[model samples]
Target: MRAIAYFKQNDIHFSSDLPEPRIGADDEVLIDVSWCGVCGTDLHEYLDGPIFMPKDGETNPLSGKQLPQPLGHEFSGVVAEVGPKVTKVKVGDHVVVEASLGCLDTHRWPKTRLSCTQDKPCGACRKGFTNCCEHNGFTGLGVVGGAFAEKVVAGERHCIKVSPDLPLDVAALVEPLSVSWHALRSAGFQKGMTACILGAGPIGLTTIAALKGAGAKKIVVSELAQIRRDFAQSIGAEVFDPTAHGTNAAEVLKKMSGDDDGFDFAFDCSGVKATFDMGLAFTTFHGVCVNVAIWGHKPVDYYPMLVTCKEKILTGSIGYTTLDFESVVNALQNGDIPLDDCKKLISGKYTLEDGWEKGFMQLMHHKDKCIKILLTPNNHGELKSAK
Candidate 1:
């Protein structure tokens, strides 16, 4: 089986003859991947090396898997085979795999308490939100193999059935959209409130769609990139180009709405320090500010005083839980969010054979022009150009 593997930190070495994934247990299902979305975390690993991923000699205590793991996770595919115990889904069913592996610690909630390797019952799992389980480990980020290849083996608990009406190519977007669902849920967005989203990247754009579906009174998107700004506008968001305006972003939003009254809620998806600050600066007093971005380095001036003074609720949201996935899938089915436009977020595409330096490098260097770039694997010795 052909797949993209990380031979070392920051190096993407493709192997055309990698061994195909095999089912390790009766609860697992083997999937033939149709499309996999290239995530920003993947690009970060390509340039900055492994940070979120497990290091050498480190293992996921639950799955007992080692490091230098497989890459792609945002994926959609069909059931190639299923273990005898996997009776919920049948062979040849189209499905999207939840790439997350949780800690299974419901009481530990969001923290990864399972790092201690204890035998405690997770609190989050006890509440039926096992996706945030601190006792279990992530599948794609922690496991050795993920959906980056021709075939991937995921536990049956992670598989979600998709209607045939959803195109296979577009189904790969469900995972990322699920993240947007989780963000809104964590922020507690309401129908009559206004929201200002920082950074109009893929996640930010998806959040706009989610907010619209949830009936947000007004949705404003701040983006420096013109292309992304245009896309946000096309999707009914009041788009603002911070760079072009030359005014303070927070001030601009207040002025446009005719008051110093800040935004009801602000979300940061860019992970940049500037955006995080903007999210805080623009939020209305007693409002909520959610940091949806994943960061490596600590940014300067995180404004603890402002949060205290304004009595604002500041929080951070990680990946999606199972409920988030259900919400996203339902929104897609109801046409609350346009799946057709979600496919347009694909800024670039590559085959697995494109190699690391070329395929992954294109994503890293071309941020302005790229949104969600994907790498398709040519299984069964089928090789074709991806121009």
Candidate 2:
């Protein structure tokens, strides 16, 4: 098995002789990975890692994994083998992994759901919010082996069957799109409402598409990159260059909203100080502002008076739930999310050998030119589109 592993901060390697994983439990499924998307967390692990990767001397209590763990969470594959008790999917099913690892053993009854059933489950899990389970860790990130390899094994609860007609590469996006879906649902988004997305990165772009599919009446996106702005526009979103938008990007959003009003819901997917402030400022009074990005210890300073005056609701969304994943898959299958537009987000492709230089580095330094890069293990040296 050839897989990418994280050894330390700024250290990741692709090994051709890595040991192959096998199905060890009756509820496990082994997948032949078709495509894996390089995510921001993967980049963070490469540049300033050990953030999520367990310390060299410590172990992840849930997965019991130490350093040098396999690294990839957003992926899709074919079920190469299935444990005898795995009844939700067969050996030849095409599926996208949910990736979020919760109390796998306790949440085994309903294969389609990922909830804890312990007498005293975590507070979040008790509320049916498994994504916030106290012991949660991503499968490829720090729990079980990841999908960056040719094959990886995961519990059947973490695998969601998708339509075989869906392209495998596009199927890799189900996890991230589910993130956006959960964020909107958390913010109480309703049909015919307006939204303002404060970024044009991969997640932000996906948020726009998800909003459209959910029946949003107006979608406004603020981005500094011209290419991303163009991409947002191509998807029927009104985009503005944040850097050139007057003194503050919020002003642009307010004007766009008309009558000096603000949007019904605003999302901060940039994880930056400016974008966070803009999302708060541009949200209508009594509206909701959702933080959908991972901010690594970045302190933000803003007027608390603003929140108090508007009676605004400030909330944050982490991972996705089973319902969120199913909704995105349904949207993709129903043609609500256009395949051609979704394919535009994929900027490049690479093999596991060149994933470091071509995939991670491309996103790190050339973010203006790259959106989402896919990597494959069996398809060595193949750089064509995953579509």
Per-candidate clash tally: 19, 0
The CA-based lDDT of model 1 is what? 0.73
Best by TM-score: 2
lDDT of 1 by residue, 204-320 (tens): 988887887788888899888888898888888888777765546568875553337778888888878778777777787888989888776765567589899999999888787
Q: Runs in model 2 with CA error above 4 Å?
A: 105-120, 258-260, 380-382, 385-387
Error of 2 at 387 (Å): 16
Residue 138 alpha-carbon offset, candidate 2, angstroms = 0.6
Model 2, range 117-217, lDDT digits (tens) per residue? 45667787778888888878787776667878899888887788999899888888888889999999877899998888988898999998899879998
Best candidate (score: lDDT):
2
Candidate 1 global Cα RMSD? 4.2
Candidate 1 similarity to native, TM-score = 0.87
Q: What is the TM-score of each candidate against the true structure?
A: 0.87, 0.91
Please list all clashing residue pairs in model 2, or write none if there are none.
none
